[model samples]
Target: MDIVSVALKRYSTKAFDATKKLTAGEAEQLKTLLQYSPSSTNSQPWHFIVASTDEGKARVAKAASGTYVFNERKILDASHVVVFCAKTAMDDAGCSAWWIRKRPMAVSPPRTQKPLTTRVALSLPICTAKS
Candidate 1:
């Protein structure tokens, strides 16, 4: 479909049918699509958590309930829920190396090695594991 059609159809869903679950294949496809989603600077600073099983969802539900108690059920019953997390700080975790490798201008001069600007996200995700 067209972008406009997709945009128009997109809306936040409040309720999900617990009985209806996404197949493994469908879940995989969703993950692949999210991975390829465009982001600023191609930093790919985002991490995702996919909860497809009851146990997995429960873990996510616990986190959601701590804050958004009403919205927790949406996560509990959804076929699959993806939690997107953005990295807050760049450290020796190879984030600087990654940026320097990807962007030539990010490198500092030989005379003076300067730290690269770090990107920070507002909130951290409770789940850090990838699907």
Candidate 2:
């Protein structure tokens, strides 16, 4: 589908069917898309945490509490949540901690490739510290 079509179809959902969930294939596709999504200077300094299980979602919901209280219910109701995190730094070491040490080519669909090296930090659903 075209970008305009996709954009037009997108809307913010305050409520999500609690019983509904994305299939494994659908979840993988979403992850791949987020990984390969373009960024300025190809910095690719982002990491993603997918919370699909009840325990995982609860953890995210806990972080969403307090100042982000309004997002708690929406997060719990959703089948899954993707927490996109930006690295504290964009240097080679920082990238290596999450992404490849060497510049790596973006992987396309159909083939599932392990694109990153390792995760440096635990999943923080709502990171509020100033950069």
Candidate 3:
């Protein structure tokens, strides 16, 4: 489908059926999708916390209090809640950590090494700059 068509079909789930839950396979698929989602500069600086149990849902719902109270019911009734968190800034240490974690899976031709390093170096300031 084209981007416009997809956008037209997109929607927000205003309500959820509390009784229904995601199957293990469906949940795993969702997690895998999140893991492979693209990121700027290939810096996968994000974390996802999935809450599937009643207690976990309750804990997650707490954040919906006050101004966000309207979302509490949705959060509580959803079969699975995924909290997406991202880093506001990436420091040297954070970069090192990310590199270490991604090193094993990062495979590239020797010819691309210099350009890859340059790209990362250029993007670091943008990622780390405080807004």
Q: What is the TM-score of each candidate against the true structure?
A: 0.71, 0.66, 0.76
Collision pairs in model 1: none
lDDT per residue as tens, model 3, 1-131? 59999999989999999989999999999999999999865678789999999999999999998999999999999999999998777765676555556575776538735544443545565344231
29-74, model 2: which lDDT tens digit per residue?
9999998898654556678999999899999899887788999998
Candidate 1 worst ten-residue window by lDDT: 120-129
Residue 104 of model 2, lDDT score: 55
lDDT computed for candidate 3: 0.79
Candidate 2 local accuracy as lDDT? 0.67
Which candidate wins on TM-score?
3
Worst-scoring 10-residue span by lDDT in model 3: 122-131
Ranking by TM-score: 3, 1, 2
Clashing pairs in 3: none
Residue 38 error, candidate 3, Å: 0.3
Q: Name the runs in model 2 displaced over 4 angstroms.
A: 95-131
lDDT of each: 0.69, 0.67, 0.79
Better of 2 and 3 by lDDT: 3
